[model samples]
Target: MPILTGDQELEQRNRLPTLMEVLGRRTLAPVDLFSFYIYMRDQQRSVDYLDFWLDVSQHMSLCRHYVRELRRSMLVETPDMEKATSKRSSALLENFGESLGEAESHPSSNEKRSSEQRLSAFLRHQHKDSSGTNQSPAHSMTSQHSNMNFSRPSHEPKPSPHSEGPTRPSFMGSDQPQTDSNSPGHTVARQDIKASAEKILYTFILPGSEREIVLPQSMLNRIIHSIEEEGRDDPEVFDDAKDYVFQAMERDAFPGFLQAKALGNLVPLSVLIRLIIGLASLMAGFWGGFFMILRSIPRHTRCWLILPFTIGCYFLVSYQYKIDVVAAYLGFSEYTFMSWARIREPFVRKLLLTRAMMASLMFVAAAVALSVLFIFVPGADF
Candidate 1:
């Protein structure tokens, strides 16, 4: 686990590695990932970013849904359009709705403080409380998650998997026909997309809304101009905002979550198991080396372990391919970056599972060869 500090600058650096690190990652079900974090983030009063992100991201799905509809209109040959879209629609939309379901409720109560205001207040308090000038947000006495004690609302239902903003529409309009419908049936047309985009602008981009987000003035102006000028319904309208919001989550919100969950220290069981398997394969390679060594010197006994393991490994590692290809192709893959968050559980699991299985086979070969070596060499205690 990384030592979180009072220094905000150092904390930022600590989070940078989250993007590249792909080793033992815990893949949370989309529901769990969003629900848990949103709840946790809510404790800090910073749930707006996630809420905004979640809402904006739904547009991407709406875009895809539109594409499938367009494809059907064109009579293109395709399969399984609704098969994958339903769960995702719920995962994305429901969460946004659930979290912001209380949109009518004003934040006048003490518990409903602004996340940025609360965070800044905490920082100011910390500055006065301690002589130390620099503090990472995670370990800062005033940071949001530190005060929550990691409690969550158990009875409350979790919303769908979304980032912080309203959902955006996608540009691609080439999806298949949905013969059978499912839950969260978000069949968006151009007008619906335009309306949703306008709502996002009003809530997040426009200045007067209660949930107004902090975006660069120029970028904000650009988005406002694009949609308002032509009354355009392009899914790409929210593209810049999406990138900005995703980065904000990566920089600010994610670390607080890691700190709150203490996920840095806890490895998911599946990932750990796969890691062991991958290492086992490496160990098996050593046995293969032993086999080569024993073969060179005329081995006296035909040990069952050495020959079998060696033969098994010969066909194992050479032609290996990603095992999760089918899952990915079928859209089990993570849709948005923020949905996966910093740990990227699903992505890492796919990598480890594929590599580990192949490595495990090779591992046995190496182990057997090593055993044979010890058996043949007298008094060679390892």
Candidate 2:
């Protein structure tokens, strides 16, 4: 029924949220968050930004994974933020008594106990406990329920129903209730706890704007600073800021970011072409120098004599990433700073030409040296 994809839309359009909306989801699956952007932006042509998305997903995954680990290590009564949350929860509860005055008639003891039980169950669900066994909260609750059987005989130590009035609700010194494992309320509370955990992780891992795509460095710095400012009120703000910064800078992290495929490693096809041109120049120097030296013209012709040498030298000097094989062989002391000539931004191709010249000189020199050494060596049979 949609106008966008039309007939094609029905097959692909499953009523998914927009990219920005997915990115802002309260509970985001790491893969879903990243794929949405790639699908929206037409990834094939936007190869450069692929690294950016990879970084975002990796950080999100890591932050989510680490937070789950942190939560798994904590008990409801002993959370990582024990000192802070304890004080805050205590302070807030002091004012809760008045709010409960009206609800007291509805069996407040049972209600308070229920809330505590839910909290305990939430924690148990997150962590398997110290027993090194896989005991579920429902299993434990079932066991406790079985132990509370009120069907004992009259002679058994059961107090008379008339003697025992309703139990007084004591929020301060009582256990919380445990809802029926199959009840919707229990499922909803469990989901709420999970949502809260994720939010805490999100705040801890990405305190900033947490953009779906990392922007330019200049923009990122501004966002980071802003997030840091906002994090002042939230103790977990640092973690969030750290997560974003880590992801933004992660491309340069090498092995850790091996999958990111950043451009820094991929010299542009144009740059590669330039490098090839430079390599070819090395040949020009070698051949030019050899041909000039081969012509038996008088040495007094400085201009003619120096032409090949100069040509070869130019190629030698033009080589990039320190490509001066001639200099290395001759042990010649021409200023090595010339080697950096290839590395300058908007690279100079002169080095390529120079490298060829150097190659020529070496060929000519080796040829002449071999001819003389063979003719002059003191042996005998010549």
Top candidate on lDDT is 1
Tell me the spans in candidate 2 whose CA falls farther than 4 Å from its real position. 1-50, 60-69, 76-298, 307-310, 313-382
Each model's lDDT comes to 0.42, 0.32
Instruction: Give stretches of model 1 more than 4 Å off.
Output: 1-26, 29-32, 76-186, 263-382
Q: Residue 93 in candidate 1 has what lDDT?
A: 32
Predicted candidate 1 versus true structure: per-residue lDDT over 61-143, tens digit per residue: 44445433433432333235642443443233333333332321432233322322232233233334335342221112232
Worst 10 residues of 2 by lDDT: 258-267
Please provide TM-scores, in order, for all candidate models, with all chains considered together: 0.36, 0.22
Identify the leading candidate in terms of TM-score: 1
Q: lDDT per residue, candidate 2, 1-382, as tens digits?
A: 2234223432343332233233332112211223222222322222223333333333323223323323332334344566364453333232333323333333224654343333333344333322323222221222211111112222212222322222111111112222233432332122222333333334223335222333456554544453344222111222334345444433332222211111111112323443565456545544544443555333343233234434433333333323344433332212112221112111112332344456556656744543443333333222
What TM-score, to 2 decimals, does candidate 1 have? 0.36
